[model samples]
Target: MGCATLTPVPEAWRSVPQAARITDLCARVSCASRGATDVKVTDGKLVASGKDLTPQFRAIQSFDVSLERREVAFAAKRSDNFDIGLVSLDGSDIHWVPEDPADETDVQWAPRGNKISFVVHSRTGDLVRTVHIPTSFQLTADFPYTAVRALGWEPAAERYAVVLTSPEASERIERLKYSGEGRESVVAPAVRLDVAIEPLADALLMRPSTLHYGERLPLIVWITETPFEWNDARGALMRNARVACAIVRQPSEAFWTAARAVAWIDLEKVYVVSGAPAPSPAYPGAPLSATSVVADPKIPTGRYRVDDRIVRAPPAIVESVAAGWIAEQLKDRNGPR
Candidate 1:
């Protein structure tokens, strides 16, 4: 079947640069710049950029920049604590939450944009606590854990997904659910790992791979066991596995392929990255020239270069593409039928 066509953004809106900072909500062009332990947002009109509140932190783990709101939310790692903060566009109002560091893996804003969720590591680092944003921005409530590695809100804003490491097996996938709700249903499951050995005392391997939102889903690259040769084997046996995508309204079951890389754009569409030359019929004729390519809204063209060796694309680029598509879809849905 032909791919779904996404509505194009109006020229006025399309001309505006993608928002990179919280303040971008108000300004036209906003960008984020991270320094030695600090993150800042600069806008078209602003002379000075907004800086991180806790500059002494070892590192800023992750943050979301809002150009439309002129705000930034980020997490910092200190010697003893994980500090989460939200700063306004002008960098005047700073809200913070500092928690004891047990095993905090990640932090993110909730769908409503009023709260945040974070993962806290147990003292032993074996267990994790998915915590809700506390009343003081300093308090925390334990969230359910199925070995969360990464967290994100769904497009519909009603649910979220936690990319997780399975406790029962040596595998990684995503767990999806609604916030303040119970256990997460499995969104994507682990891809199987295949291994092969050669006479060079090394190994070659391939496995199923899944990328989170904006990541081209259904990636087509294999994991190399030795990190060197194509067919060397040095590790475990190979297994047959499937990679899947689980969006709120759309879910896809895809088999892993050695020549093709795929990423989830949403429920109905996917972004593909291929390393080798593209095949005819089942596959597109040539490798996507852009760094990554999405197959939603009828295969739009892009400007980035696709790297054949590495299966991953730049995160910012992926985010920009996804956001643009979402914005277009939102506009379409709101327009006259």
Candidate 2:
């Protein structure tokens, strides 16, 4: 027998009304311009831009954007001088925290929204400074260069990675440490470069992550044949070109040996590669290709299939493979329920 038709409820009767509705959160955006070197953002209906500006250089640098305080901050170099400044995003107000006339490199936003940290150079020597904000930001103190280079904040900004560079060149991996202000101590030593530090695509390329999210990651270091004229060494010489990664993180000492590669697709997203490379010829030198390229998410197995003939992996496939490997690591580390 066929079922009987039932009466349907009216649209007005079925619809439910809420006592109150929540509005959307305001978006806080900040950007830096080359011509002005000014950081700007919008606060509510008003637009604000910062001052104490300088000409932008080709090097990749970043600034802090505080939505809570509605301000933009960045480091600037003028007359061979480095300084940090905060200003309204609309160009109405400006505040400057200038550094001593010295070489300042790798200025970055502190994990906290209210402070900035950077490498500073003075007549005495090179140092690192962490500056407080709002109630007049200023340099708090100077830390050793080793700590400065390895300085990285934890996910929550509460802790930092502290690395020490040894005076001896052979002891490259012996220098890195991870700790807070009062508990400074070495966490790992004799770490391999490929395993110790991972490079971020945006940071290594000297470009913003937003613009290069899907682009191929560049090689941080490569062994390429050097021109004979440039090299005084008699035989065919190969030189290592060091490229800095955009972001770096220190994993627990236990997992250090298993780690093989580190990469960043965007500011917040990170991917680490591990496990042994496939046997050579069939898989080549490293199971992974020479260059760390960004991959597409839709690919099979989350890794790139190499075309051995050209000795190059497609950028899109590379990113996908890296992403897949990272996903697998997360699963294994987290464990299944």
lDDT of each: 0.35, 0.34
TM-score of each: 0.36, 0.34
- Tens digit of lDDT per residue, candidate 2, span 70-164? 56665554444546556565444457676566656555555545666666644322455666665544543443223333344444544344333
Q: What's each prediction's clash count?
A: 37, 14
For model 1, what is the error of residue 280's alpha carbon versus the real structure, in angstroms, after optimal superposition? 59
- Residue range 1-337, candidate 1, lDDT tens digits: 1123333433332222321212121122121232232344322111134443334456666666544455566666556555656666565656766555553546555554455556665421223223344454333333222234455565454455544432122323233444345444443332323321111111111223433455432322222111221111111111111222111111112222312332231223233322222223322332333122222222233322223421221232333333333333234345565
